[model samples]
Target chain A: MGGFGAEIVAKYNYWIYVLLMMIGFYAMIAKRNLVKKLLGMNIFQTAIILMFVSAGVKHGAAIPILDKHEVLEHGVHAASVVNPLPHVLMLTAIVVSVSVTGVALAIMQRIYRRYGTLEEDEILEKIGE
Target chain B: MSGNLHMFVMAAPLVGALTVNLAGRASRKAVLPLVLGFLTLSLVAALGTMAGVLEHGAFTYTVGNWQPPFGIELRIDHLSSLMLVLVSAVALIASFASLQSVAKDLADRQHHFFTLYLILVAGLHGLILTADAFNLYVLLEITSITTYGLIAMGRGRAPLSSFNYIIMGSIGACFYLLGVGYLYILTGTLNMADIAARLPQVNGTVAVATAFAFMLVGLWIKMAFFPLHGWLPRAYNDAPIGAGVLVAPLMTKVTIYLMLRVMFSVFSPQYEFFQHPDVQNLVVWGAALGIICASALALGQRDLRRMLTYIIVAEVGYMVGGVWLANGTGLTGAVLHIVNDALMTLCLFLVAAAIISRNGSLAFDRLQGLYRRMPWTMAGFTLGAFAMIGVPPTCGFFSKWYLILGGIEARQWPYVVALVFSSLVNAVLFFRIIEIAYFRGGKGHGHDDHGPVTEAPAMILAPLLVSAAALVLVGLATGPLVSNLIAQFVPVF
Candidate 1:
């Protein structure tokens, strides 16, 4: 029990992300309100973005930028810099998430206009009618 | 010129999309011509790329002259090249048929619709061509976003259904991104080839296994495979027929192609098939169950459009099962089915579009006496129905034949049974439609009400006939296609 607790504490970042993801996933599936569901999706995407950003961390490394003269003279060591690829990839991800949110919000407005409500059950009932 | 033909294949649609948006604001008359002109250019370039690939083997084009493992690359192998042609050709054919429907559905927003349409074409082409794992995610989101916009432009409950799709699609895309994140952490590279190379060194780790699982689940959700397929039918049914004719056929098939890419390119077959026998067995069984269930659900749908949507779900099950069979024959069938199913689905959707334009509804009751009212349209519909039923001389039969052979070889009897059962179900479903259209008189009206032979316009019939013809031609060319194109790509099992 003690070792398990220690392991959990050591990798708390991953645990937090997983916990956040589960919460968002639950909201997405369980919520009755369409706006809430959209919020859940945003939270879900944010958790993943955080996971990706965290994956690039290094203990004592500096940022990825390097001085050209220093890199040519000393020939830089790979371990001295935090990985930049995940951060770069996450930038694209953030853009994608924003675009998705924009589209979802636009569709939500349309749904509200047509059904006069943002609840899934109510919208479905109206569709049935 | 040939060396960079792949660039043209993607760039043409992209540039066309921008041109449509800008020129459309000036004059609506230019929208259709611009869309068609660009799709034709893309198709020509795609054909040229296929020729180049066949003549000189597969090649990779580095974006901005940046080498792989650092810069993004577009890899054109036999499978991706064939898919490129399929995407371009289907977009072109569907565009030709979309004119009347688009004017009817989105009369005010035609340019905007064409803009989204062209971007989707470009995004699908990019999805097939990219080698970067991260770039694939971006392209996936681009396609999903464009699809959401297109579907929302539909009438009635389309906005609500599009909202559901947005929720489901975002989750799928995020799961895929998470998987790529896991791979990046382990391999320190975002290139698929680099990761595959590094994976063996980190084999047996729980992280690697988890990544594979996440990625496959993500793609299955995106492709609406069985249990995760709740979003597909309603979304496709409510979508504007113009968009339905395009999205229904290509989106799911391309995602299946991505699954194959992930299974083979990012992870070796040895790792996928040999290392995890238990998982592979479970997945194949799941696929079989999915096929049976989707086919059963398809049987219950009342509307023709809704029925076709369920058929798409069943077809997805076929390819997923074929891939999970983990044999050369099964994988070959999956690839071939991807092409044939795209064309088959397009042909059927085109027919639905024509019928919907005339009747404004596709409920089974409205279809009586359609055969006499529109013989040419019915002819195309019959060809599509035959293909769906796996009748000989249509492309569907050849692929299903290979799949059954694969199931037998793998001793997966449940999959074989499921395939035969689904085909039989399809026969009953399509024949029921055929019987109504051919035999029954129009309801609430006399036989005289069956008006003159006012067929769908020539624009719609031309593409329908061409696709119907391609069904036979593709089936006839199956021998060479398998030997030349598909055989070269199926990983040695």
Candidate 2:
């Protein structure tokens, strides 16, 4: 199975995650467009969420529903449960990322209102005033 | 909970931060005491935990009272308790020093500043106390998000900087989460102690190395380690003096502390090849370059605050170097330097803020006669400068002394040279500002208004003095303090 896992190789989701992360990071660093930066930031965060969800999935595994009868049994009793933990954790992270994004975009709107431009270089020029 | 004042102490400041926000609407004067009272309580709790650690092995408080693997735990070992004390102590001083600047800068928004400050405090407290790796990630987010907010509330351009900060900061946090996720997938656990226990069984795998790389890279980003420090200088430069007080001093130090913990605690030294000399060699070279290179970068800066911001980049090098030394002396020095650098950085920023507040800007030429008009402020600035230069009898000296000795002990000549070169560079960097403040910009103006210039108001001065006193006290008792508090906490790795 481990050998089979090796043979099955990388998927589209993994490629997209890496590409999206790099693009987001590049937009953040290279682009001087403030609005473009926010869009980039959101794009970057979405990639991580993708990574987490992708991690939880296997080639073949059922949803992590526990067997009800094995109440307090320990050693290897509940194998192949494909881990509900990552999914739960990722849910919280998504909420947080979204909440912060809302606030950031509002601030971006205010910045545009004040500066009359979304270009970072122009806003910086005005600030230098 | 008998002799264990640990829970309450850490909890109280956060409680104060939360409650003060709620209560600030009722009375403004009452707010300071409320916050101060909790910080004092946190300090007392730290001392109690210290006593607790000595008596009982270590106190662990799992959230929701569940078992370790299933629940989030707040562990108060000797190391965490010391951090609690240091963070609270700096926080107490900064909060007091904050009143005037925050009042002037934030005004009706005082409550908001305090709220973010407390939340940041809570995050720092959480980071130090949390026993679980995944839990650390959550707390790290809380800190980073609040830090962005705190930086955003500064005078101007703050929101822009904070926005940029969030982008970089989120990437760092995500990297950390990925690292933790990797570990969990490999080891089937998230608890630090549990991971340490289990890792030895599967020591030489590619998965663990990848996990280590992921975690280290994430932490390096947070620590604003040289190349990854793109977001830091502007964030510091743009934050308000009061908010700057907190972020500039403690945030990166906490990140560095966590890096050390991960390197030593989560992946034990003797148990694995995670602490390979190859990794240490790579990191130390990065550290040395950060030290020398960032200092050189600072020399080119024209803005006073921007220069200080670059110095922070250099200081990270100092601490990272000590950690990579892999010796008790160097680790102690790095740990000790964290507190020392905090004081030095805080002092420099406070003085620069005073200068900026006095003048309309922090341009180098605007600082002439600053020393004469604000003698006490200049005196404090002088001490901080000398300390940054690592002069004898200052806290900075001892930190450098130990780090250099570690360099010698480890037979790393380049690191020792980097230390000497950086010290010389810092002297030039800080004194350049002093010279401008004195010779070029020091001419007295025929004005009577204080107007956020001259010496800082009592509120700001109070916290400034408290940290300055810590600088001296650490210098005097360097031997006993680092041994009892930090050295023992040093992970064998």
Candidate 3:
């Protein structure tokens, strides 16, 4: 029981991310509303971003930015700095996520305007017309 | 100096997209020539880069002068250079082919169509050239978004289908992103070669396995590999003829190339995951089933474009299965098929576009006596169809021969049988269309009157004929291509 508790605590972030991803995946596949699916997609993307951010965490490291005085006096060691690569990469990913969301929302608007419903089944039925 | 040429390969189409868009706004008439100029520039650059790669072998370009493990890298190797040339050449041909059809099908959205077309081509170029995993993801989304827009522009139900494609494509891209994140968590580098070097240290971990699963699933969805192929047929079927001409040929083929890249380049083939017999068996059998089912589905389609989309699904299975066979012969076949299938699909789709542009429909019934109405177009279609059926001396047969040889070497009898079965199925499929077009008398449509041969405009016919001739030329050139290009690049087992 103690081992289980420790394991859960140690990897809780991954568990949470998995839970969020599953929620998003379920909505994407199971939900009928296109907008709801899009929301799920956003949630899914955000969860991945969270995972990436968490992956960059070094338990006791300082911010990646260096102090001028410390740098001037003595060279800063890389060991004290948190990993910044994931953060940088995720910044690009976040922008991509936003663009995808924008395009998807616009597409949803077009879908709604054309079919008069955002429900997938209803849209399909209308398309069959 | 030569390294910068790779940058030009990607930039030319990008600049073309912008110039075409701006030119469209300024003078509608200027758009076509401007698009042609830019794409021509891009094709020339791609060819120049290909020559450089052939002479110098594989090299990497560090973007912004930042070195790898920190900066985005673009690796131009035999494989990528080969794909770059294929993509730009196809885009050039398809865009040229679009001259008449875009005017007809896309009445008002001609400018927007060309803009998105160029963007799609640029995105594909970027996808093939980028060496950073995250950069590949970004380019994948670019290609996909542009694709959704292009597909939505088609008449009737196209918007809905494009919406469906968006859902599937975004989910696929996100899955890929998550997989890349997993890899980043395991190894701190995003450069593919760097990650490949680092991955073997943690090679068999659950995290690595999960990453592989996620990435493969994501790419399979994108490639529309049989079971995950729900979004492809409708999107391709409902797309505007001009858009279909571009997307149907390039989209899935590029995804397949990405899958191969991830398999061989990003993850070293020596990894136990690739060597596991269970995984190999699963892939080969899954691909075999995909071929049979997709070919059968294609046989049932009445519409020409939809039928070819299913065949694309089947051809995708061929490449996947060949690569999974894990022998030099099989991987060679897969690589060769990548080039062969791209040209074959481009030819077929161009023929479809020509038919629809001139005759106004793609139904099998409407094709009765089409050979009389459009002789050159029919001739091109016949060449493409012969290639599809794996007739001897067409490029398609040589690739299949290599794939079958690989299957035999791997002792994958089912895959071999499936290939043979698919060829027969393809023969039936094409012959059925041929029978209707060539042998049958036009009854309801009165198309048999031997009407004046109104071939597709030179814009379309020229590319069609060039691609058709290319079918035979590439077939003959397969030996040199395999020896000079693919042999050096296929991973040493």
Candidate 4:
């Protein structure tokens, strides 16, 4: 429990995900740049993928696939089957998030054309104008 | 009709979506009737299906004839059948509203517009019918993505509003997926009935709480409840008139239906049998605050579109407050209001679209003295406005009446006050615009930019008149609807 260095390495990926989500939220609310905000949103959503993947992790797990149905079934002395469902769900969510980001970027492109700047302050100023 | 009418009930709209998309592109000259014909057919199918449910009992269509737990189920229980009919009925009205609006604005993009509109309708139908949680999420995205494209077709700030909506909508979908994942991890099943039966075994598990919180936040975001509703007003206001007619009226509502499904069926122990008074109190408090704050906000808005947006937010509070009251009357009111609110909101937005079409825009200042010039439009708006405020001789009143009675039954005073205050606030908000429209502008004629703006074209007018009629009809015939349709659908739990 007191092995600090080992623990950090073990859950390093999760920490990175948290950092990315925070950066996105920070950029969304704090930063003035709209392109950067969209970038932040993309990073934020990808962070959820990290969360889901980490939840699926097992220390001594296989890829959760086998030729025989018996191997997939629960057994007394069976190797831990890696959870394939989260991986599958994360795949769908990733596609949706990317589609949303693509559309957001398109909107950002339009906003740039109409307002002439992607910075929040400048855009609001222009909208006011 | 055949006894196996459930298949036709659900599949007709899906086929219509496909056919409309195909026909719109292939027979460009035939877009109007092609789309309208499909919507009208869907209406008949939905109503016939509802009638079947009323007569033949609740129907379940097993996809590919696969049984539950191993495969998906599409159920048309009293509640689901009722919701489907309401949704399709409004879609029919919206199609009429969209006909003229789309023709005038998007002649170049007619096919794409109708395609997306019908696909959105199909997605909505799929959402209501699906008995699998994952299937619901799939259909939810189908509507949301299509909704983004539809809203972006608006002329003014639609692109921006659509963008904001996408951001919030993505967060919501992800939250819902997270909840579904939690349920799957705990129960090892995706089918809703299977999950409900299995949930009792793991009633107080941490997974259940995680799933509940995830779903609560997710549905709140999707339904645009209070603080989470920042995206709604702009999206509703900015979308093209036709898009507004479809998306504004249905989007939040279908999400509300999902929330109800999850509350009653999926998270049965969480909402119903567990008897979580604290959670109930929290929801009631939030809904009350939403009603009060939104009404206040609506009172201050100068833009007609933005004002309608705020009213939508407040009205969500009405439904949430009613549902969370957790009584027979409360549940019935909440469920019935889902239909009533959709029709009324559709009426208002369609009429607003007509107003927008006639004038260059619907800014408050521009709407003055429109009463004499456009009596029919004004009358439609008046009906919608009165209905929205929950006044008498309208279905809107019954929803509030039941909600208040439920609140009183639940020994709730603040919510009753919230309902009353919200109604008054909206009255003040809407009447100011009417007063300006009737009294304030130059004598004997209209504004400078819009020269002698008469009533809108029939395509727009027909749908609006239909929605307005539905509001009055539902209000007048509240007893039969409450007893016959809604009570059977929404149980006390």
Candidate 5:
């Protein structure tokens, strides 16, 4: 039990991400308002981005950069620099999330224009009528 | 030159999209021709890539001449090569048919529609060709965002459906990204082959299993397999006829292809099949259930286009079950069905497009005396329906044959039963349409009485005929296709 508790503490960031993801997921599925659902989606995506950014961290390591002169004088230690790939990947993911949000907002505007309501149930009622 | 063909396949549509945006601003008439020209260029390049793959076997091209593990790689094995041709061919044929519908439905937004159309095509080509897991995620979003835009352009509840799609699609994509992140943390690589190589060292780790689960679930949502399918029928049904012809045929099929890539390429067959028999069994049963339920739902739809959407859901079940059956024959059926179902769906949707263009509706009540009004279109529809019912000499039969044989070999009786049941349901669904269209005289709509044979315009008719012909041609060539192309790609189980 002590070892498991220590492990949980050691990886608390992952638990936070999981909690954030679940919260976002709940909003996306359960929220009645379209804008709130979009917000939920954005939150969900942010949680993923955070998870990816956290994956790149190495304890007591510098960001992935190298001094050319230092590298020439002595080969650099690989462990001294954080992994850069996950951060790079997260940048693309952030852009995708933003674009998705933009498209969602645009569609929401259209939905509002047509149905005059952002509530899904009300919109369905309007569509039915 | 052959080595650079894959680059051309990805670049032509992208460059064409930019060119169309600029040139189309000058002359709206230039949009269709420009789109077709670029699609033709890409199709030719895809054919060249397929030829090269057939001649030289599978090969990889590194983007910007960077070495693997660092640079993005575009891998063209037998499977992707066939898919490259399929994507390009379908895009070209579908675009040829889009000109009339675009002019009629989206006259003011021609350039915008074709721009999204070209980008969607490029994104699909990139999705098929990319070997990096992260790159695949990026391309998936590009295709998805463009689809949302296209679907939203339609009138009446299309924006709502597109909105729903955006939510579901984002969740699917984010799940995929999360899975990739997990794999990266485990293996320290983003390239698929690299990750697969490194995975064995940590094969038994919980993270690997979690990654696989997340990725598979993400793809299942994207493909709309079973319970994850709520967004598909409405999105496709309410989409503008122009977009429907392009998206309905390709989107789910391509996602299924990606699932195959994830299962076979990123994870070893042994890992996928032998690691968890219980999970595999559960998935196959789920697919069986999905088939029956989707078919039943299809029967309840009053609209013809909506029914077709449910049929797509059922077909997704077929391919998913085939892949999970974990035998050579089953995998072959899944792969072949991917091709056959795409063409079959394309043929059917094109007919729907033509009918909608002429009649302005696909409500079942509106289809009376369609055979007299649009005989050629109905003829094509018959061919497609026959294909869907798995009649011999149509491509759908051969794939179904393989899938059933596979199910029997694997003793997955439920999947086998579901296949037969779906076919019967498809026959009922289609023949009901056919009988209505063929036998019932036009009662309320006055134009149908003594109406001349007003087939779809030549542009639409030509592709419809080509796809309908290709269905039979593909069925006849199934023997060579399986032995030469598909058989090579089936992983040794």
Candidate 6:
């Protein structure tokens, strides 16, 4: 319960999210292929959704839905249930990410049809021609 | 009743998009009338909303009778309504101007083009009106995706450019979502006003600073601030004239408006992030560098549309720097430039479209004798170029005047120098085109006897004329627009 072990245990979720995000970001910028960049974008978006959902979790908390009998017997406590707002927001984010990936893939298909290659520099050379 | 007008403005374009899709691609005649009908309706609704704001100052309309921190709200303040008026006005005019180009450039894909165009319109309106932080991201993606669709429909090399745009734009949107996640975790509210009230208590935390940095960088990239502007020149150059006219005017300008909105409404003007001298210096200096570099890049362009896109990057620098100057005058200048730059860019792009439609090229070498070829379009282009150069009695001049005044007040000499230097660069860039077109590349040929003066069709020339005239009218009326519209709403630290 002391020093580095305690600190890592407390914030491991955030650490993982940040790590995944950096990997995605690096692939997006440093990769050569169009499909790889698209994958990197998806990974980046998924990492964000992960961060949001993790932020909403609480230890020893029940589902957000309330039971009438429990509410009648004992008043509802805010901390007893996981936060539902971030989850709802992330649902929309997930849908947006899906659509973005679909559109990106469609555009990549067109690029392939036009230029016959998916590499960044190769496409440029084709365009130059 | 006013809220109903606001709701109608957001809904009409969406309804039109669906109807146009259902009408089928065979009925090409039905699309333009339907698109124009919906845009006109939205324009009337937007005007009503603006009148309501003028009468009532600023107000909020809650959805489903639910209060803030829970259900979404539409905040129709002076700022949002002003943007609404500008967005709808430009949409209507741009759609009108698209009639000829859509037929010429996208003859077969007319129906699909208008459908996506209307959806992009609806998304922009929603983005400006929403009070929820999460809703803005949703609408931003809607606009961005529709833009990608529209831009990809262009003639050549467009697929590659649009794909590059998709990659860069997705990264920007993801960064924005990550920033919003940070803010939501810090304060358990999704409403902007609620977050603003709760933020000061946890002011200087690392999380808050990180959130600000993320959001700022994300928006800067989306707005194509200097270093991140790689996607704009190519994408806009390759896009069809119709989509280019609509997206070019509204996209970056709206993002700049969002930056101002977040600075004032979501983060409070007095927040330490804005008040920190080092942070302020860094942003202002970055904006300054952006101006010089973009202007320099523009000087090297041969294509007219590509050069105009670089000018957009430099104009973004103007607005961003004005806002970061952190004075009432600077904020006013920023807001004023948002309206003026939108009109100026619309005018210029419309002229480019007209020239391309007739002359079959936007390259400088092909533009020889254009002044005599299309005199009316050339006149409009002249007004737009003068505005871009910050000449007196143009709207651009007034905004630049206020920005320079703000720079002097803030003692930011570098921003002032960049402002003056960019102005000179714009003059040189624009006049070079003028030299080529008017003098026919110095051959001293009076008029080409073989080619007659074929002006653009009425649909195209009319909007160009109206927008060019509006630039001057807006400049003349800047006194009232500031005192009545922009001055009262600027955040006071």
The DockQ values of the predictions, listed in order, are: 0.93, 0.49, 0.72, 0.39, 0.94, 0.87
Which portions of model 4 miss their true places by more than 4 Å?
A1-23, A54-83, B1-22, B269-275, B440-453
Per-candidate Cα lDDT values, in order, are 0.92, 0.80, 0.88, 0.81, 0.93, 0.89
lDDT of 6 by residue, B1-493 (tens): 4657898888999999998887847688888889999999999999999899999788888878898879898799888999999999999999987867987777878888988999999999999999888888899899999999999999888988898899899888888888888998899887999989999888989989888878878888789987888999888888889999999999999999878767777887677335577998888999999999999999999989999999999999999999999888887898999999999999999999889878898899999888878989999999999999988798999999999998898888899999999999999999999998888643445646536789988899999999999999999999999988898788675
Instruction: For residues A35-54, write the lDDT of model 5, one tens digit per residue.
Output: 89999998999999999888
lDDT of 4 by residue, B1-493 (tens): 2255555655666676677677777776788887777777777878888888888778777888789876788878888888888888888888877878888889878888888888888888889889999888878888898888888888766777787787778778767876887788678888888888888888876768888888778888998999899989888888888888888788888888898888877876344434567878888888999999999998888888788889889989989888888788887888888988898889999888878777767889888778766778888999998998778999899988889899899877788899999988878887888789777776455454333658877777777787888889989999998888778767644
Give candidate 4's error at residue A74 in angstroms.
13
A103-126: candidate 4 lDDT, tens digit per residue: 777777777788787776777677
Model 2 chain B lDDT-worst window of ten: B442-451
TM-score of each model, paired residue for residue: 0.98, 0.91, 0.97, 0.91, 0.98, 0.97
* Tens-place lDDT digits, model 1, residues B180-200: 989988998989989999999
Off-target runs (Cα >4 Å) in candidate 5 are A1-4, B442-449
Query: What TM-score, to 2 decimal places, does chain A of model 6 have?
Result: 0.88
In model 4, the clashing pairs are B154-B240, B368-B437, B369-B437, B395-B475
Native contacts recovered by model 4: 0.24
Model 5 deviation from native, Cα RMSD in Å: 1.7
Kindly indicate the candidate among 2 and 5 with the higher lDDT.
5
State, as a TM-score between 0 and 1, how close model 1 is to the true structure: 0.98
Task: Report clash pairs, candidate 3.
Answer: none
Chain A only: list TM-scores of all candidates. Answer: 0.95, 0.76, 0.89, 0.79, 0.92, 0.88
Question: Comparing 1 and 2 by TM-score, which wins?
Answer: 1
- Per-residue CA lDDT of model 2 for B343-430, tens digit only, reads 8887877776566555657877766667666767777788888889988788999999999998899887888899999999988877
Checking candidate 6 for backbone clashes, the offending pairs are none
Fnat scores for every prediction: 1.00, 0.34, 0.63, 0.24, 1.00, 0.89
Candidate 3 C-alpha lDDT tens digits along B35-140: 8888888899999998999998889888999989788888899989999999999999988888678877665678888989988999999999999998999999
How many pairs collide in each candidate, listed in order? 0, 6, 0, 4, 0, 0
- The DockQ-based CAPRI class assigned to model 6 is high
Candidate 1: stretches off by over 4 Å: B442-449
